[model samples]
Target: MRLAIFLLIFCIFEYALTVDQTNFKTCDQSSFCRRCRKVKPDNPKFALVPGTLNIYSDSITADLIHKDNKHLFSLKLEALEQSNTFRLLVDEKTPLKPRYKVQDALKSAPKPGSIKVHEGDTEFTITSGPNKAVVTADPFRVDFYQNDILTVSVNAKGLMTFEHLRPKPQQPADGENAENPAANDVKEADEIDDPGAWEENFKSHHDSKPYGPEAIALDFSFPEAEVLFGIPEHADSFALKSTSGTDPYRLYNVDVFEYIIDSKMALYGSVPVIYGHGGGTIVPKKERIRRAATLMKNDPYTLVVCLNSAGKAEGTIYLDDEKSYNYRKGEYNYINMKFENNVLDVNFIGKPNFKTAAWIERVVIAGLGRIPKSATLIIDGASQELEILPHGEGVAVRKPGISVQQIYNIRLNF
Candidate 1:
């Protein structure tokens, strides 16, 4: 019947294509997010150039002047000694050219820790091992810390903007002279009053920005974080709400189609990775029941875990290889979980390739609130004593030989 009415009109045009928040964009339609949310923490035209700070051995550069067009801009602050992770980077210390960076989105190039620089006068601190960052200078900020506890702050709310790169304004000949001298030297090299910095139209579609307003805004906060989750490919709601009167979580990577769930829009995959949980004090149930599970060798991987209401938990493990990036060269496989005083350790290193395939066939272990009539499994060191299952609020420790060399030592004694 004409191929069943062309498969029923392609399933009614793929269920009528959803998600169209007016085709995405707000922050007053993004002229550099409306000049970085109208930058004002008493913005006396920004600062931070006193002595231009340096401190290297893995990053911390400076120079950010713009006291009304003194214009200098460039601030970096790396520190990722094997993933403790912190990277700030503002741009344009010198640029009439080179800008656009988002390249390959990092999977390497970070390892460089052991820092310790203190300077102090208007702010400068960098410590490393229990983390610390500081770096203030009048209106420019940076914060971040861990053992001193304040975790992440960047541009505190002055909304660090950086739209520099100009030249494109000459149009004055019909008897020429509105102020023409190549349009007043491109209006004195575009001094930002920003009429969308030379062309933008949106729905009727225009955009001609042509490398004129480089656009880069900042604002990370987190402070004492009472829950904030990853900026995933949003259909929204794995708990991340509160943008204080809407729209501030957009990560940009679109292709909406059926998206309209809680909606911060921008869907179809964009992992900017945010995660912050109820902050400070209370991570000493011997470091909250020590856990270090690392099972990587990707395959439909996703492990979220954000239990707060004070059971204090934090988790994020997303392996990949949906078809191959070959886990980027190391190939991959390793899981190490350690539970402490009540004992429950696991360790499954790699490379025994029995033709690969079997990155953990089964292992459940949910919250475990109670219901421990009995449980003890220790493969590779041999010992088995299982039988416990209520599996609702918690309690379901199933297990079945996780692959590669394998060595588990589970022991839940409740």
Candidate 2:
């Protein structure tokens, strides 16, 4: 009798719950997103100021000016040490107050790497190792090349926008100089240009935009990319699709009740990194197993795993330390071990909840010396082919979506 009552109550609760889309704000409702999206195509507005380029050993600093507003912003380009990575930062040259910056994203400050600069009449070329970044001055654009091949371009779409900080305009008194030219101009501009600059309302919630408008936006282009992925916390496909006319892939974190699939809306968390790939080729049918095993043996996987299983599963294995920890305090020791038959066996814990599956996507294999180009999965003594797509210096393993509450004997041999 008690069990029957519990089951009846569970069914009633599940049936009563439903996702209400109106609770979340869309791109049109967001004043900043709407303003940024309205930028015309291929019309550049920002340029590097002449005689303001300051070149350093590991970085370059310059002043960028907006064509219409003439707003000045500081630009810094830095190369990180021992890694083929570059950082770009832009902010107002002189703000009324210090702006808020993200914190604790990195373990520590990265040591600076050496950079070679080749100044040109209209552009600046900075090279680190075999990769180079070409910065065009007039339009303020950057193109990145790996091994002399065009890989990624920054601000290439001319959608870059940075709202400068300024004091709020004072309202004119009802009777005192109602036609003052300065006050009239300010009032006219606010009414004609910004609709939600000071405040906005979404349903029952109201937002007093204390900062007025301080949104930053930029576009990154991958010319030869076949698939683009990342910008997580979305119930979407493994490979992201185009969001051209609709709302963009948002990166805000919010509690979305029973989120919809194939949607770019943000969920409970966000990881703002996008990876583009174009050099993935299918391995031959016969040689897939051998090539995969070899690649797996040469590298170590160092990221998250989203396991899919039906019932309780158990397995164990041993691996040599990959030397990926802080060893300066004598807390880490590197070791080398040879697995039985030189094969690494991995066990995964499955998450049967449908909503959680969308939150956890691919398995990233990192911290190894090099990323594997291919991967092989063995389940119940049968070979299952898988692709090892590249994500920066790591590899992402993706498989077909599996339904929840299914059981199978899964073994990974990489």
- Native-to-model Cα distance after best TM-score fit, residue 86 in candidate 1, in Å: 18
lDDT of 1 by residue, 167-267 (tens): 76666667777655554453343377867867788888888876666776666788666777778577667778887656688777775456776667767
Best by TM-score: 2
Candidates in order have lDDT scores of 0.62, 0.64
Report the number of the highest-lDDT candidate. 2
Off by over 4 Å in 2: 1-15, 187-192, 280-414
- Residue 323 lDDT (model 1): 57
Assess candidate 2 and give its lDDT: 0.64
Q: How well does each candidate superpose onto the true structure, as a TM-score?
A: 0.33, 0.66
What lDDT score goes with residue 390 in model 2?
72
Q: Tens-digit lDDT track for model 2 on 1-414?
A: 999999999998876675677777788998877888887869887999999999999999999998877889999998877436688999999987779989998769888888999999999899998778999998999998765667799999898888877676667777666666554565322232656767788888888866678778888998756678788678878788898899888887777577777788778878889877543111111112445553443232232321112111112222222343433344332222111221323332332222112111234433344555565555456666666677666456665233111232223334
